[model samples]
Target: MSAEIFDICVIGGGINGCGIARDAVGRGYSVCLAEMNDLASGTSSWSTKLIHGGLRYLEHYEFRLVREALRERELLWANAPHIIRPLRFVLPHHAGLRPAWMLRLGLFLYDHLGGRKLLPPARSLDLHQDPAGKPLKADYVRAFEYSDCWVDDARLVVLNARDAADRGAAIHTRTAVTAARRDGDCWRITLQEKDTGRESEIAARLLVNAGGPWADRVLSLSDQEGGEGEEGHRIRLVQGSHIVVPRLFAHDRCYIFQNTDGRIVFAIPYEGDFTLIGTTDRDYEGDPGDAAITPEETAYLCAAVNDYFRTPVTADQIVWSYAGVRPLYDDGASAAQEATRDYVLRRDGGDGGTPALVNIFGGKLTTYRRLGEAVLDHVEDVLGARGPAWTRRAALPGGDFPVTGFDDLVARLSADHPYLVPTHARRLARLYGTAAWDLLEGGEAALGQHFGADLYAAELRHLVAREWAATGEDVLWRRTKLGLRLSEAEQNAVADAVAELRAALPNRP
Candidate 1:
């Protein structure tokens, strides 16, 4: 056990865990976070990659969740403009499902429910005349267009962890929390290093179980006397999967297709070359890590888009697909699609000299900041308040520039690095914002070995040194989606380069 104690120790390195660590540590709390894998390697990275209000959730009457998420869209965009941006979604009217009048009413509420400002309001579209209607079936004559935000989900999680670490929090990647025991006024945490089989211990006044899909399993590891499994806060393991294919449309706007089964699917422009589609929600079992897109899911997604698009999508067209298990707080909703997306926070102990435990369940990417603030409320209740809620207005690392200034940043980056092509500069500016300059330091010669697809040794070094990226998978997939564009030989070279870099660089904690 460490002689020094931390104020809080966070388990899991997903968006929720990283967001809580950032918020708590920013509020003067001494924090330590442990992730069993690379940051955002789990559920966080496998999202449909949108920071939206969940328009379909309105039918479930999740008004509060919708409003909260809707309000957060622009705030989060401003905080991380490099990875998040506004996306207009077109919902074409089907003949039998959701009448046009009802759609208008729902959209009106969606526009007014949250204090939407920077994002444009919902508007009706004449599909016959609008460019958005070009690829859609002729059956759809009218549609509704609404605003949501697209996000680089993995980067968002990493940026939060980066900001937290920059603010003095200890972030431990590839470290698993083996056990947590309440020891009087504090908790003793056992951590096992995955690589070297080394075991160590630390003490914290409070422990936060932000384990997304493994919340129940995490509770099983806790020495809680007489506490029911998960302490009555059972989570429903819901698997949501997405697929990537060659770009289906030429325009920038996304499509939200309504399925006959009452679920919804989104087809958005991704990586400038492919179209991103998916998100099938179904009750999941077994290990969340083992979750993958079933054939039925793939077909369902293809058909979902096929129903709306003039041309059909097929299985062979899919280039990449991923699945994630959402650990939703099970509210006994019969269908997986009907499960509540609202977050629930449950606290234990922290009274009369007892250590505290806060378990977080059921949250989405759009509401991670608010979820962190709520978690801190429980933290403050246990440890007393250290700082006021400050994340709403704060800019995440590399996101200090204006949200609308992305073009200017790209132009400046292109001008500064004459060696960089316009597309490469734009890509860097989109991924790193103002921080691209830091990555491009020492000019063109500094980029070192070219690993294809504009990936370079200097970028890999920066990821290892600053972003806690240990493997090429972390670099290619999470840090940047270069994996989609890089060929097999190029990927193998990147893996080798990352391994060599990790061996040479000082270890990060």
Candidate 2:
């Protein structure tokens, strides 16, 4: 293949990198994005999976960050309705904790801060008389219900990469940029294939360091490559973790439980058969790829839920757990929870001495799209403008239909292929949106293999062919949440089948 020069080369296949690539490529810039591992194998996939403005952030008075996130909530939903949907949260009033008046005031500001058009406004609930209160303690007599959005976090990252790829950008997964040097006005980039130990060279007019947890590592590479100073800002690694257990409540509304230590934990309905609870903020050191939930963290999460729920959570009940380290811009906060969630963009070589390197820092999944727009604004400023910002209204792949039309799409999909079971059809429609037909082309009979829980070979092939899935974890956990549903032996069977399938495949991405 010819080493065609690119206008932009992004290092990272997480949400930020893919979002930027999609935006840049849509604007007519030649782009290439390389991920050291599977897309969103790190921070992006490990989020709380909510697209709402940070309700707890109101205590820190981060109005600007909250406003931007709130604005993107509905906008992102409209663009990717298949993977994004509205969710309601229940915040019960505690007699000795945050006063009811203060809670009301915060919700009021949250409602008006961002343009609240698509979602319903917040309302007070008589927990004693409401079904949402059935799972809560008797002491929690009253609560407030508010709106937010849920996202399939990993799928969001993959969809962004897919959109970028469809828009003419090359997405290189399981590939790492080993070296980068400034070659006059261009960046001489060296990429290593993780599997075969092969290396290749490419060139780009600009370089973007969107490596979330590895931002500093990639910036160090550029410094060694071009003799540039370590101009990238410092970042603090904060570990956040969650636990999933058998369903604790039948209600769809989630609970935002307040702890005495001034931290909040959420209990949300997940995967139809389980409850998702989590997130403890603690400073972390060492590699982010090895992040895992500790016994203490698991205990803390269980206790957090035990504090508010009638159905007490215990460590033995945890069916699955995950953890990820966030690379937050270091503002020297005393506590990890106190750290800022807002993003920072630092540009090097802006004075025309070498190729520009843009360093991304500290962002939430909720603001990824807006973050992309801001990144390209800097790129457009350094390089020549290619086209105006266009991602705000453009839907991601499989997300062309309206958010409310999801059930209708499911019905349509089942009708076209009568062989599909109702559960299978719903899963496909929810995951692929308008593109479900492409993944389920030949339906049940032609679906290469059946790996339990509606995870057929047809969908697996589509994930590998289109979404860059590699391992069983990538297929079971990220591509789909079947990891929690599949048994150990069943999981191994799927892994062996996928490995055999991978051997027959041409390339990783």
State candidate 2's TM-score. Answer: 0.97
Q: Residues 1-509, candidate 1: write the lDDT tens digits.
A: 37779999999999999999999999999999999999999999999999989898999999999999999998999999999999999999998998999899999999988899899999999999999999998999999999999999999999999999999999999999999998878899999988888999999999999999988778878975323655477789999999999999999999998889999899999999999998999999999999999999999999999999999999999999999999998899999999999999988888998999998889999999999999998899999999889999999888999989888888889889989998899888888888899999999989999999889988998898899888889999999999998999999999998888788875662
lDDT of 2 by residue, 197-308 (tens): 8999999989999999898889777764422447538788999999999999888889998888889999999988999997999999998999999999999999988988
Candidate models: Cα lDDT each: 0.92, 0.90
Q: What TM-score do all the candidates reach, one by one?
A: 0.98, 0.97
User: Could you tell me which 10 consecutive residues in candidate 2 have the lowest summed lDDT?
Assistant: 223-232
Steric clash pairs (candidate 2): none
Worst 10 residues of 1 by lDDT: 223-232
